[model samples]
Target: MSHATTSIAAEQDGPADIALSEFFDGHPVATFAIDTAHVVTHWNRACEQLLGWTKADMVGTANHWQAFYPRPRPLLADVIIAGAAGLESELERLYPGKHRRSALIPDAYEVEEFFPNIGASGHWLHFTAAPLRDGNGRVVGAIETLRDVTERRVAENALRRAHDNLEHVVDKRTGQLADINAKLQEDIAQRLLAEAELRRSNLELTELNQQLSRAQQQLLQADKLASIGQLAAGVAHEINNPIGYIFSNFRTLQNYLDQLFGMLDAYQRAEPSLAAPDAATLRALRERIDLDFLRQDIPTLMAESGEGIVRVRHIVQDLKDFSRVDANQEWVWADLHRGIDSTLNIVSNEVKYKADVVKEYGAIPDIQCLPLQINQVVMNLIVNAAHAIGDERGRITVRTGRDGDDHVWLEIGDNGSGIAPETVSRIFDPFFTTKAIGKGTGLGLSLAYGIVQKHSGRIDVDTALGQGTRFRVRLPIRHGAATEDPTA
Candidate 1:
């Protein structure tokens, strides 16, 4: 070989060896070489930085198994020995002391049980060892590389824990929400049922109210008929008294006329001359039978008959007034006092035994109303007040006055045994009364209530069991005016 050829070969050899050493030293992982005696031979800068050891301190001096893995050092022995026999194995080893060191190393080393020595605060390392072969393919030593995987493993564990916790929380919250939704559904169902029941109850109540109204109307009609019957009986009794005497007077007159006719027939049967003489006898007979008394008694009988006719006419008029058949005939401004007086006259029979009436009439405006209907209402109330006294000779005070704007007020008060608290609430209800069955019809107050309401008015009662009762009725001054009266 020439000098130039030798120089060229020498230059190529020098750079190639330097390049190999530089590549090994500058690697990002810890690099080391183990000898056949299972001892560390070479250590790179990455190894020094990772393990806190210098190459001169650990190389050729100690085995990695004795220094790093104190307990169970054979755990790495099997892995490395197996790799030397062309088998693959991986070993994990944990170091004692603070910042426990953990490592994973794959083995295919020339010597058995050979690993790198690491230090405290060292990152977790994953290492792979490959058996170094000579040109003849004979095992010589091993080169191992280690990488830091501590941060990745720690982050993966943290992420896994967080994921697990989130799943657990989601499952718990989902169960709670389902329970709440079920409760809400139950509450909604109960509310719907309650509303349906309320609607049903209201419908039933409306039907009951309609039935009660119809019953009330029937009761009122029955009561009016009863009153009419009583009045008819009274009128019949009154008429019979006068009629009996008038009929007796007519029979007496007929007997007197029969005696006179018999005397006249006797005169006709006598002889004509003797008849002239019998005239004196006839005059004596007439005088003795009292013809003048008969003539005077006949006029008295006619007068008695005329008086009976007048009484009947008056009774018929009272009946017409009580019935109010002509109530809607016309509207007229009427004196309320006069109507009240008339009502007092009609019910005088009711109160005569139990109560006395006193009137306190104030200057009031003439109210436009149906006089007959108002009279009926007043009479009913007066009679009720009398009956309430119950033979106590109580006093009833009837008063009239102008109330507030556009209203007229009438007050009828009784100094009688008043209403009981329990009965007061139902006093105006139809068929409710404190009196005995034959003495009272129970429709008096109810009819009065209806009549007052028809006139756009209200009736209020103030009573206490020993404190007497006062009933105040408020009516509009004008026919169609609104009423401002509080009754409850």
Candidate 2:
């Protein structure tokens, strides 16, 4: 051949030799090259080792379809044709027949079959294919490769299943936790509401207790006033008896004096000449009339009238001391005995009918208190004791003493039908009375409690049904002094 023809032929031959040499390298993948006529142009050392074939057996082979795959790979043929006609294509493929003559594959290959190829010595093969193109971007042939990827595929499928199961378990646990949290929040809300209700109930009870205390004070005051009114009526009757006699004697004396004046006037008119009587004659007439007796008797009468007026003044003073309308006034040192005596006098009428008072006075110090209010309290307690006895005569005991520390105590007890357990608790409330409607206003004990509280004192009672009742009042010895009364 000429030199130019020799160079051109050498270049063509060089590339084919290089391509074949590169395919013969001991790579793991089975590689092959095919021509546009679908004939095998080259086969690698890997293909020969995996498929039990050599380059001598597969090269220049027109059966490229049956040689590269254990079965004819139909999808590979389609992809090659389309790409040769200028289209893009991609696909995945599984290996054909099973190794060791397993029943998974047939001897003759088919397009749809995935079978492993087993050589005589029991080697397994896996296959995949792709189309090849020339520099002009036109598909000219195809290249196929194969591998042993059985272990890898199995492991990947197991891993995917495990991940899906784990996800499902996590979702279920999250749903359960959300339910538990919602229930816990609802329980907490219910407990809070219950606690709030309990607090409100306690507040209501406290308010009711305060109201009861106030009502008791009002009842005590009313009882006291009723007793005082009854006493005043008795005292009025007592004083009226003595006053009636004194007035009758004065009227009789005035009549006698009027008669004597008439006689003297008649004498003066009858004897005009003797109208201006001599001093000696006038003196003799005065002597006969007993001027010294008239003077002595008139002075005695004036003195008796003054004594009656003093008695009335004493009664008035006692009444004023017993009634205490100014209970809010400040405290002062007060004689406990004097207060008890005044209260007893005020309620004497009530007790006289059904009870007798027994005094047991002690040498107690003056108690700091509102005197009039304290007296009113005593009056209420004493009178209530008498009323409790009804028609039966009972003994009412009034006692005074000093307690430990700076306090004075007065106790009034009666031998009468006592209070019931249920009734005793509410005995001091306003308008709480066992007496008939017209006879009691029920403010006595209630007012007494209020007065004691104002003085920072306390009043307590002990009683049993059918065993009589005892009321005890404890007052401070010294307290804030009372201010001067503006009305005084």
- What Cα-based lDDT does every candidate model obtain? 0.68, 0.66
lDDT of 2: 0.66
- What's model 1's lDDT at 481? 78
Per-residue alpha-carbon lDDT of candidate 2 for residues 292-329, written as tens digits (9 for 90 to 100):
57756865776687677666656655665565433333
Position 263, candidate 1: lDDT: 77
How close is every model to the real structure, measured as TM-score? 0.43, 0.42
Residue 57 C-alpha lDDT in model 1? 79
| Candidate 1 residue pairs in clash (backbone atoms < 3 Å) | none
Off by over 4 Å in 1: 1-185, 188-286, 291-305, 328-349, 353-366, 370-372, 392-397, 436-442, 464-467, 485-488
User: How many clashes show up per model?
Assistant: 0, 22
Local accuracy of candidate 1 as per-residue lDDT tens digits, 284-342: 77699786686578667766866776666555545545544444434567778877865
- Superposed by TM-score, candidate 2 places the C-alpha of residue 14 at a distance from the truth, in angstroms, of 99
